[model samples]
Each structure stands twice: as C-alpha cells, then as structure tokens.
Target: MEEFEIDPQDLLLENALRVVFKAAEMLDAEALTPSQLKDLSGALRDATEIVLSIETACGCDHDHGDEEAE
Candidate 1:
C-alpha cells in the first residue's frame, strides 16, 4: 500500500467526527446508515492504529495512556 501524508490535525478532526457519529447512533439507531457506520468504524480503527501519533504530537513521555495513574 502506498503511504500518503495527512496533517495530524486533520486526522484528529476526522477521528473526532467519527466518534461523534458513533455516539449519535447510540442516541438514535438510524442516525447513520449501515454503510456510513461501517466506514466510520474503519476510520476510527485506522486512527487508533497510529500507535505513536498522540505521544509524538503532544511530545509526551507516555505510551498512549498505558502509564496512566490509577
């Protein structure tokens, strides 16, 4: 697969919108069509798979919340 560049901000925004859509479905089952929901799920998954994005973007010395204090 050919890798293409996308601004981190843009990816974050898109992922946030996907979360909103996913939440909307809980409020109203018909809020998103089946195909749209599937696409959104894929988008969310893709964003999450970027394991270093959050740490790199924020310059944090953490590994995606794995070290959160209990």
Candidate 2:
C-alpha cells in the first residue's frame, strides 16, 4: 500500500479548476455564434486569470497538483 500527502494550496487550485471545467461543460459550444464564442472565450480567460492570480497571491505553486498526481 502507498500513502499520499496532500497540500492545502493544491486543493484550492483543484477546486478552482473544477469550477471552470463544470462551467465550460454547461455552455453549449456548438450553439454559440462567432460573436458569442468570442465573448465566452474572453470571459473564460478572465475567470481563469483571476483564479491564477488568487493562487499566486496565496504563494501557491501552480504545478503542485500535477506533481502529486504523478
């Protein structure tokens, strides 16, 4: 058996990623017009940037989760 260690900072980033993925899944990509897709892309990018900023401000490593999952 193997034991795993979890970091609080990584957990926060994971939660943020989960929220974005869920929101993206809810949107109907195919139904979006060119203009709508442009707007959605900008919104999603902004949301992700904000989350990244939060992670950085908290002094959390962005790649922390990837290392743990390996």
Candidate 3:
C-alpha cells in the first residue's frame, strides 16, 4: 500500500483560506456590531497575510511571466 503526503505549506494555506472564508461568512450574516466588524476585519487581514506568506514559501509567484516582457 502506498501513502500520500500533503505539503505543510499547502496545508497551512488551506487552513488560512478556511479562516478567511469563515470570517467572510460572519461578515455576511449582518449581525455583528461595529467592534466585532473591526475585529473580524483584522482577523481577515491576518489570514490573508498568512496565505500570502505560504504562497511565497511555496514559490508560487503571481507575476505570470508578464514581468519578462517588460
């Protein structure tokens, strides 16, 4: 039997995305107060940073070869 392994960076990115999605859902519920909204905004920002960091660590560049033309 063969076992498959998931990359740690990929797993971290997935979890970060999940956190952002959950925060979005909370924002969509329209039941939070102004303070809650501010806190969630911070949480979302942190999650986004984590996702970007993981992408950088994985060498997933977003340039898409456009820079080469310049």
Candidate 4:
C-alpha cells in the first residue's frame, strides 16, 4: 500500500469535524436534564457556520511568497 499525505486545510477540516462530534458526545455525557437540547444543537450549528466562514474567507488567491520588488 502507498502512504497517503494530507494538506493542512484537510487536517484543519478533519479536526473541526472531530471537535463537533466530540462536543455532541460531551453534551450527551453531561446529561443536562433541565437544559434544553436547543443550546447544544445551537453550539454545533455555530461551529459548522464558523467552518463554512473559514472556507469562504480562505478561498482566495493569496500568495505565500514575498512580493517581488517594484
């Protein structure tokens, strides 16, 4: 089998997905009987929104190298 390499952006996206899953697991473990599910769901929704925002903001043509001399 060949080794696989992942880009930094892929790693970031993976981490974000893991975090969202973990957040849901944590909420389940906490067993917040009194609290409503809306809050926990909202948190996950917000996290997804942030991920989309990052994708949009970074989806541009920006160079990593220094600018050329005029």
Query: What lDDT would each prediction earn against the true structure?
Result: 0.65, 0.68, 0.79, 0.70
**TM-score computed on alpha carbons, candidate 3:** 0.66
Model 2, backbone clash pairs (residues 3+ apart or across chains), number: 0
What is the lDDT ranking, best to worst? Answer: 3, 4, 2, 1
Highest TM-score model number: 3
Screening candidate 2 with a backbone cut-off below 3 angstroms (N, C-alpha, C), the clashing residue pairs are none
What is the per-residue lDDT of model 4 for residues 1-70, given as tens digits with 9 covering 90 to 100? 9998887777667767886888778777877654556666776787787677666667668642334442
> Of the candidates shown, which would achieve the greatest lDDT relative to the real structure?
3
Q: Which has the better TM-score: candidate 2, or candidate 4? A: 2
Error of 3 at 4 (Å): 1.4
Which ten-residue region of model 4 has the weakest summed lDDT?
61-70
Which ten residues in a row are the worst by lDDT in model 2? 56-65
Off by over 4 Å in 3: 60-70
Clash tally for model 1: 0
Error of 2 at 9 (Å): 14
Cα lDDT of model 2 by residue, 1-70, tens digit: 9999997656766776775775577574457678876776776776687676765576545665475588
Candidate 2 Cα errors over 4 Å, as ranges: 1-26, 59-70
Q: Write the per-residue lDDT of candidate 1 for residues 1-70, one digit (tens) a residue.
A: 9998987766776766677676667547657778876876776676565534655576656565665654
